[model samples]
Target: MKRILPLLLTLVMAQPLGAHPHVFIDTGLTLAFGPEGRLQRVKVIWIYDAFYSLLITQDMDLDQDGDGLLNPDEKAQLTGFDMQWVEGFNGDLVITQEGQELALSGPQDVTATFVEGQIVTTHWRDVTQDTAGSGTYEVTPYDASYYTAYEVTLPVEILGADQCRSRIAMPDITADLDALRQELFALDRQAQPEDAGLPNIGAKFADKVVVTCASS
Candidate 1:
């Protein structure tokens, strides 16, 4: 006789995870600049939601002792698991300078730890080149698919410079959502279901840190 998969397996294979948020994260960013006022790197800190943390802790199977705490081995395993993004993810962090998108290298100094029943990861990424030119710069962190919601939890910081001030601006997504609803309402019933859904406008809901420098 041939082995058979279970009914739940068949259902899950037919309908994979949808484009809805399943995880949430609290993010903090620190902008680092050289002594010459050239932007150098960005440090990111992500704290997983308590419920997600519980899931991660259980999934990793690191707590061999069943002590309700992450052992050293488990900590080591989580140090860079999430930071290691695939070819195109970029960890959902986007930065633009003077209306041009800046290319950032991979993350370095990746680390993870369990704190207050939450998993926290920290890493830093360097820009491909010095972006010291006088212009407006913005940094936004968001997951394009909205599979995870990222919220800014720390005040924006400008390191190694006193002339530049950073302010966090949260984009309003109400208009975008309302527009999408209206579009769906007006869609023809004969149209395919996939053709009448809202667009992936996750970026519209991201919070940005705008950095302004003193005029020369």
Candidate 2:
């Protein structure tokens, strides 16, 4: 009975965890200008995470007293996580002031590269021991995409010596910002390598709102 039970357990664990559904969300922003400060620019960030898991079968040498899934006492160290894998990673905004809200999808006059962005990433070989890895060959630069930011400037006329920038933004990412940190910890505990996309990945995120001029 004991032997049969072990086999059944193994079979059950072999089944896949099933597919993860995709959910899309957008962070909304609003800017209100005051008579004190000037609104410079309004910014927003859209983050998406899509994850799939893969199982790796490692050779376990029990006869030789190997302690891990590796050949011997070999340990794996991870320096950081890459968040660029998320798809549809782009965003733009329509500013509304007083009672006028500019429509992005609606037919209207839109100018400049406000909704467009370019990505840049820099990387270097890093060893966990705070020392070089064997020889220089041990290190290699890993180029990866970093999340891009959406930026738009508020016209300068609104800064007429008396108006101070007053702003109100919707779907603030600060709370989710805190939640994502916790999400990563949970994924690690589950030993979920593919779950990496869920942490820095945003359910929905928005930057601050700025109220400025109507020209740009």
Quote the RMSD, in angstroms, for model 1.
6.8
Full-model lDDT, candidate 2: 0.26
Query: TM-score winner among the candidates?
Result: 1
Best by lDDT: 1
* TM match of model 1 to true structure: 0.79
Model 2, position 193, has a per-residue lDDT of 24
> How many backbone clashes does every candidate have?
0, 7
| Tens digit per residue, CA lDDT, model 1, 1-216 | 011124422432344343344467898988888877777889999998876676666666756566667877788987886764667767688888877888898889998998878888999999776556456788888876444678898656779767778888987658766675455445543333245454544576678888887744
lDDT of 2 by residue, 1-216 (tens): 011133333433455532111111123222222333322232222222111001111111121332222222322111111222233322223343343433222111111111111111112111112121111111100111102222222222222323334344444457766675455434522343244664323223333344433332
TM-score of each: 0.79, 0.22
Report clash pairs, candidate 1.
Answer: none
Model 2 TM-score, all chains together: 0.22
